[model samples]
Target: MPDQTTNAEKLDRDAVADRLTDLTEELRAGENVTVSVGNKDMVLTPPETVGYKIDVIKKQSRFRGNHETVRIEIDWKPR
Candidate 1:
């Protein structure tokens, strides 16, 4: 199957914290995770064992100063 992507973003500190907390709890509980962006929603159940990756990029610009973005991804397939 081809990969599909949906992007959701928030700059508010509280909003970002809430989203991160929700994701952490779902992963820790081993529950099916459901996420909604605008009118589209997706439910995913990761396998018992999965591969995880994290990437953080830092950038600097004369106009914008410095900033960084972190991306976390998980992958799994049932046997």
Candidate 2:
């Protein structure tokens, strides 16, 4: 069986920048990142080598105006 996890949130620009900064530091230090949502949490440690992909989506609606999403995906084989 494969394990799956997800975390989603809504935040303002400043908060989003802070979150990105934290993620950058963690990646630079090669540390596991802990994902927590409510009372549930998980830690993910990436392998020494990994593959990366970026996906971007743009949307527009009569009522919603314009919206964009950027998703980054990482993949690696287990050691």
Candidate 3:
């Protein structure tokens, strides 16, 4: 049988990704926010006034089988 533990780990990672997405949106909306992942938390504040720019990149990788794998990548330049 496939490893059930691996499935659970994947689900947990997906949840984290969803949270990160939400935080990114909030940051772009000019909200000061802090995000915690694992043992680290990042505090972000939008630039003062308007016309500020922010760039974000996210990458993920997963191994599915002996020779199968998957990756997800997102790039954003917030205005």
- Those runs of model 3 whose alpha carbons end farther than 4 Å from true positions after fitting are 1-17, 48-79
lDDT of 3 by residue, 23-79 (tens): 768767776656554566655555544343454555455764334434443323323
Model 2, span 10-60: residue lDDT tens: 889998888678766766777686555536776678767779899999999
Q: Write the per-residue lDDT of candidate 1 for residues 1-79, one digit (tens) a residue.
A: 9646577665699988887788778778877877655477777788778898999999999999999988888777733
* Sort by lDDT, top down from the best: 1, 2, 3
Once model 1 is optimally superposed onto the true structure by TM-score, how far is the C-alpha of residue 51 displaced, in angstroms? 1.4
Candidate 2 global CA lDDT score: 0.75
Model 3 error, position 41 (Å): 2.3
TM-score of every model versus the real structure = 0.72, 0.68, 0.33
2 versus 3: better TM-score goes to: 2
Instruction: Show the lowest summed lDDT stretch of 10 residues, model 1.
Output: 2-11
- For model 3, state the Cα shift of residue 33 in Å: 2.9
Clashes of 3: 0
What is candidate 3's TM-score against the reference?
0.33
Off by over 4 Å in 2: 62-64
lDDT of each: 0.78, 0.75, 0.53
Q: After superposition, how far is residue 66 of candidate 1 from its true place, in Å?
A: 2.1
